[model samples]
Target: MSVEPLIELKGICKNFGEKMILNDIELNIYPGEALVIIGPSGAGKSTLLRIIAGLLAPDTGEIYIKGQNRQGLIEDKQDPIGISMVFQQSALFDSLTVAENVGFCLYQHSKLPERKIRQLVEEKLEMVGLPGISHQYPAELSGGMRKRVSFARAIMSNPDDSRYNPEVILYDEPTAGLDPIASTVIEDLVRRLQQAAQVCGTYVMVSHQESTIRRTADRVVFLYEGQIQWEGKVQDIDITDNLLVRQFFSASIDGPIRVIN
Candidate 1:
């Protein structure tokens, strides 16, 4: 039996003034699937994620989440879905301690007591393999630790208990500046989060590291020249002979994907 897509984008088109970013893009994210988007810079990878998160509205296209048509302005001012994003830079507040940072969303969105919020924050931090570091500030932590904290914060739930599980998690260049070891840790965390959530909630991430993609992605979508040029499972990547894919995987400068002068 075919599973219903958790998220679907049909003929999605977006542009900034005259420059087109996403062109007739169509994608479907099945529940519990991890879809990694790979592309050269400016190929609209992050833009697509933002669009899916409803942070940006496409010029033309349709976005459906959990079989509901999500087009036009959102009726609810809050985020349409239980979606969270982990930015590459681990955008944590310097003033807030790690626990406070993780619980910030809960405090703002729900009426939960401070003690309960702290407990949930600790749980999320432990889930990310960083327990008892919640008392420290972001500046006091290492880069990898900061990223893990951000991951924990992104998954933190509100006290009102609306929905503890996120419908989707968007990761933007998750391992960009981290070392190899740190990158691997982040990759493992992504997989663990998917398993723990146990929901059909989709995971869509943009990354440059082949190892990270292979480790975390169930499917890969390659974007080039402002569109998705190739897509397949991670295992098929080596066998597929698409020029763009070959060039990308090889990290070769000589390929169809050219840098503008």
Candidate 2:
């Protein structure tokens, strides 16, 4: 039997004032698959992720999480359900220690005791290869450390039968603004998380680094002009005879994707 799609988006349309950001976007994320989306700036990649996270409402179209409609969940009011995101900036609270930041969601949502939460938080930190840094504040950690903390927080939770293991984890520029070594570290952590979770959670990320995209993405969706212009695997990328794909992959300035004056 075929497994059901973990997330489905149909005919999604979004606009800011008169500018249309996304138009007729139809996509599906299956269980245990990592799908990476690569696109230039202002191509609606982040907006699409926000819509899936229920942080932004599309003017038209439908979003489904595990077959349940996500129309009513606003950005803040949406139940945690089984989704999470690691922002580009590693948005950790400066005042809170690493443990507190990782366990913040559990503190807010679950009635579990503080002791239990701390235990889980420590485990998550160790899983991400930062075992004893829980007492340190975000200000005390390095850029790569902060990203790992954010990643730990995103996946810190019980994977029980009743609660859905994250059906999707949307990563917004996971490797942006980092040194080459740091960027590789973040990419490797993503792979580790996928394997450790053992759940069929899909990953959809927006990134500019060619190395990260090649390492993590099973399939690539190239967005341009607010639409997907090319979709293919990493190997096919080299042989794709599409002009737009070639131009973007080669980082050539001459292409259908033009720089606005």
Candidate 3:
């Protein structure tokens, strides 16, 4: 691991009306590692992922990327390094074609020609195993296909500026609704994308699926009751005696975690 973290969160807290989501959260994302967060629904994993992506601001906390403290949301100021996120919903625009959606950033910001942008968009789509559907609309694709399109968009790059290449990726329930085989494909894609990242093969994922957590995670953190109750390496999760880990993995009705109706 590097001497410094690529991303760091200190005392992160968030709330929605009367309920508090994340509480006093702290984490560090090191280079060349796949970190996964696992917990039941309403555990605040997705919220923390957005905060790290700079898409959402915490009620109280600090976020640092590449050692520079982030001020306000991503629209307020750009981070020192590139950070991208694949949202849980696949969040694609109904009107735009897959190519348009994937190259949205470059189209809006870069000086690249339209032809070049299309080529780059196709390249990214192929990287995610979604080739030759750039002209199709999001509504025309299947759920897994749309998610792959979103993945393509998240990994899109600005050829004019190498600094814009993504260093860290935040994934929110990437395999949520997919079939087992499809979910496995998505997991493989995540690992492949990490190897293709510009600066480091680093990614942070939020998942509840046992296969995903075990296959993709180099390290795992267990979140519950608005905090990380346990953390360890991927294999450690099986052997660790942490009550949270034990209960979560076992799918037990009895433990510190009580299921919500």
Candidate 4:
């Protein structure tokens, strides 16, 4: 891992009405390491992921992208590096074809010619194991296929500029709602992309699926009620005696985690 962090969160805090979603949170994402954030539903895992991606701002804190303090939201300030995010719902545009959806950013922002953009789109789709379907619409695909398309979109970058390529990605439940086999395929794809030259090796994911977390993460962080309760390597999950971790993995009703109705 690199000595300098690619992304950093310091004293992060967020609130919704009277409820606190994240409290004094701090995290660092290093290069070449895949980290997974896991916790019960409503544990603010996704919220934290969004904040890190700069899609949502924290109520109080600072976000540093590649050691430089971020000036504004992702759109406002062009950071030194790119940080991409894949939403849980596979948020593809219904009106656009797969190629258009994957290449939306480039189509709208880049000066690259249409032919070159199409070629890049095909390459990204192929990288995600969904080649030759660029002409199809998102509605024509299955849930898993749509998710993969979204993955391709998230990794899409302008070949003319390295700033468009993300050094870190945030995945919000990429494998959710898929069958076991489909989930495994997505999990494997995530790991494979980690090694791909076009994609960044470092990523942060928020997932509830045990297999996805275990298979994808080099390190794991457990969040509960707006705070980190436990964090360790993937191997530590099985041996950690932390009450929260044990209760979460075992799905037991009795523990420090409060059950909400």
Clashing pairs in 2: 32-200
lDDT per residue (tens digit) for residues 104-188 in model 1: 8887778778889889999999999998898999999999999999889888766356554477888998888899999999999
Candidate 2 Cα misplacement greater than 4 A, ranges: 74-81, 159-165, 197-200
Q: Candidate 4, 19: how far from true, in Å?
A: 0.4
Q: Supply the global lDDT for candidate 1.
A: 0.85
Candidate 2 per-residue lDDT, tens place, 146-188, comes to 9999988888776323253455788999888899998989999
Best by lDDT: 4
For candidate 4, the lDDT comes to: 0.92
lDDT of 3 by residue, 4-53 (tens): 99989999999999899999999999978799999989999988888998
Candidate 3: clashing pairs of residues: none
Better of 2 and 3 by TM-score: 3
Better of 1 and 4 by TM-score: 4
Write the candidate numbers in order of decreasing lDDT: 4, 3, 1, 2
For candidate 4, write residues 1-261 as lDDT tens digits. 539888889999999999999999989889998999999999999999988887888999998888899866888888898888899999999999999999999998899999999999999999999999999998899999999999999899898988898788889999989999999999999999999976889999999999999999999999998998888999999999999999988999999888988
Candidate 3: worst-modelled 10 consecutive residues by lDDT = 192-201
